[model samples]
Target: MFKAVLSDSNILKTSFDAISSIVDEVQMKADSDGLRLDALDRSHITFVHLEFKSALFDVYQCDEPLKINVDTEELMKVLKRAKSEDIVELTVDEGNFILTFENEARRTFKIRLIDIEYEAPSPPELEYPTEFEIPFSLLKDSIQDISIVSDKIALIVDADKLIASAEGEFGDAKIEYLHGEKITENAKSVFSLEKIKEMLKADKFSETAVLKLGNDMPLNLSLKMVSEEGELTFLLAPRIESEE
Candidate 1:
């Protein structure tokens, strides 16, 4: 048996919302340390890693480790009913995941677990030459602006600045940030604008996001959660242009 309580329900809700867009079902591993999840999208172009440490919860109790397979969309439906200030409690009993919210009134939901056949794959070890930190608001605004003209965006990072640019038949747009920490190496890559937008959904859960990039390689975006207890990370493969 396992039980955990959180004072703010939005933390859990926002997490699910960020992931459910790419994956429908996920396996949540609960242990003494905390809860962890790693899932790849159906196309395998994107991978998501999540962690919520025991200290992040108001109350955490687990005698043994447990892995629960849940449908993210269904879980979001239950979490959607929770008020922002409600205390959220989660428990596992007899193969069922129980969620309870307490505020002025009490609400309870029991969702059945599924037997997941897939196992979490080991993430590839990659080295990014360029790394920088940017506020979520700035990144979100840049993506939105570039997306207006093109379906893909080119990210260029050098010693002094980070740039996002897009061009299409309609027009072209570019946004640059020259305020972040300086980097030694330079890297440039193209990525799907839609995928970046989808991953930005986690911006609501974090203020600042760290980014890593390489030439013609995937983009790694990470958001550290409240109090630095947990993190949500996305690895998006770059969109390669064909030589015709």
Candidate 2:
């Protein structure tokens, strides 16, 4: 037996919105610890991870561990109907995953679970030269700034600042946010601006994001709840430039 009740519907609404854009389906495992999911996008350009502790839920119970596998897009469609003030209950029968939203009125949706052999992906063990935290809006703004000139943005970090820069045939854009981290090494990596923007759709998840980067390596970005009850993270593969 496994079930959970969330006091706020926005938690699932915003998260799946971002997640659906990257992955078509996911296998979420719920245990006594809480609920967690890890999935790699079909193209393997991105890996996403999400964890919600029991503390994040109004009611959480698990007599035995269980897996809920479903289509991400279909789940997001149902989640979109949720209101901010609504409470959401999650459960699964043998063939269906169920969601019930309660507010002024109660609404229930049953989504058929897909049968597939699934192995939860694990985040690769990565070591970065530099890591720092910045406002979530900074990433959103930088994506806009860089997209004006190029489809790719190079992220660079020195002791003084974090930079997002891009250049195209017609123009170039650069954004610098002074990150007062006592970083000893300088690192840089280039990534797709479109992919970054896709991950930023969960703007309500966290106010700040932690970044980890190394030259020509995947970029690691993490969003955490201030209460430390939940986290959403992504590892985006870098775009490689061919040498002439």
Candidate 3:
């Protein structure tokens, strides 16, 4: 048996909104430690990792560790009805997950759990030579600006600066930020602008995002809540450009 309560519903809603676009279904693991989710996109090009510590919840109870597979879209639909100040409670029983939202009025929903054939794959460990931390708004705005002209963006990080640029048939746009201690070494990679935009949905939960990059390697973007209760991490495969 497992039951958890969170004081604010927005945290759960925002988290679901951030990942629903990337994954259709996910397995949520609940234990004494906390709740965790790890899922990869259909194309296997994007991976998302999320963790909610037990301390983050108002109430947390778990006699044993359990894994529950849930349809993310359906869960998001239920969470969408929750008010900002509502207290959200979750419980699992007989293969069904119950979600309750309490404010002036109480609303409860029971969603059936589905059987997921595949287990969550562990993310590969990699060393990134270049790392930097920047405001989430900066990355979001830069992607939006470049998307107007191109479908992909080139991210280049060196000893001095970190730059995002896009080149299209019509024109090119670039945004550069000078590095302090946030960046090191030199690395370059190209990624799908649309995918990155989707991942940025988590920006609402955090003020700054830490980015790690390597030449022709996957990009890792991480965000931690201001309250330091939860975190969202994403790994996106690079788009290899063909030589002319």
lDDT tens per residue, model 1, 24-76: 89999899999999999899988999999999999999899989899988898
lDDT of 2: 0.92
Q: lDDT tens string, model 3, 71-138?
A: 99999899899888889999998979899999888899998999999988777788988887988899
Worst 10 residues of 1 by lDDT: 118-127
Error of 3 at 145 (Å): 0.7
Candidate 2 lDDT, 45-142, residue by residue in tens: 99999999988998999899988999999999999999998899999988999999998988999999986596988989998889989999988888
What is the total number of backbone clashes in candidate 1?
A: 0
Clash counts per candidate, in order, are 0, 0, 0
lDDT for position 106 in model 2 = 89
Best by lDDT: 2
lDDT of each: 0.89, 0.92, 0.90
In terms of lDDT, which candidate is stronger, 1 or 2?
2
Q: Model 2 — TM-score against the truth?
A: 0.98
The positional error of residue 210 in candidate 2, measured at the CA in angstroms, is: 0.6
Better of 1 and 3 by lDDT: 3
Q: For model 1, what is the alpha-carbon lDDT of residue 17?
A: 88
RMSD of each: 1.2, 0.9, 1.2
